[model samples]
Target: MAAAPRWRERLFALYFLSHIPITLLIDLQPLLPAGLQPPALTELLQWYAASFRDPLMLQPPEWFKTFVYCEAFLQLPFFPVAFYAFLKGGCKWIRTPAIIYSTHVATTLLPILAHILCHDFSKAELGGPRTQRERLLLLSVYLPYLLIPLLLLFTMLCNPHYSHTEKRKRK
Candidate 1:
């Protein structure tokens, strides 16, 4: 099986590395109890919500909270492992886990993207995006998460090195 380019693996490594802080500082903030959340990070999350006009972050519904819980319990733990594997490059063990992680994240983002595109945040009184421009802006913020994971899923499934193992023949 042909190896995937080292640059691709390195790029993925950087992504996993960057996601660690984002998950801790922003994405997981909603799940943390007020007392447990550091004031500075909490303030950062608030700024993100206000600046992005992201109602989901500002007033997360129960369904959104469930996604956060999955991030905390599932995706969060996998970040370090992915970081290591991608950094090392060609750790076949990572393929399955990466496939699973990417699929799960991509799946979660679909509903979120639909909400951003279709929901009438103005009528909902959720302090969400009131205008089409604002909704598009919020959608931009969430789009990368979906795109990157989908890319990873594609790489995992289609990259020969990731999906196929070669047997060593006796000399």
Candidate 2:
């Protein structure tokens, strides 16, 4: 029945604060007009999409494109909600969003990992990560997608008030 520790609350607030810009710049920015975007932001997007001869930057597979679209549409909206929930420490409202985001990340990452592990590199259409360093560098971007959602889910599960009914049970 005790509230989560001060450090935990602070951690969540910081995590959520970091998520806001990622949602805006990475998830939501491309949907807006260029004139409406800052020149620096536009350049960042260009570099994000086209830099380093990245497979995602280059011609990606149909499945990867589909995942990108799905993530943009479905996952983008949750960023604000998750941000708010984490900012507030713990709330019943966090439960559904946490579950949805967690499931989404799990579903999205599993197949990508599978493809990476199973695919024959020489025949890849987009010329996927070639060297060990390149593969690790590419994964640096993706591993957070997997870790963040799981950590959010764990935090929600640990929250004393993750269910509103718990508030009454404590009285």
> How many residue pairs collide in each prediction?
0, 0
| lDDT by residue (tens digit), candidate 2, 1-171 | 666565755665676667667766665554555578788886786676544325553455667767767767776666667667667764666687777778777788887766654555666665666666666666677677777667667766766656445425554
- List the candidates' TM-scores in order: 0.92, 0.70
User: Which 10 successive residues of model 1 have the least lDDT summed?
Assistant: 120-129
Q: Stretches of candidate 1 above 4 Å error?
A: 165-171
lDDT (Cα atoms) of all candidates against the true structure: 0.88, 0.65
Candidate 1 at residue 131, lDDT? 82
Query: Candidate 2, which segments miss by more than 4 Å at Cα?
Result: 5-17, 27-46, 49-53, 123-126, 159-171
Tens-digit lDDT string for candidate 1 (27-101): 987777776888888788888888888878867899999999999999999999999999999899998899999
Please report the TM-score between candidate 2 and the true structure. Answer: 0.70
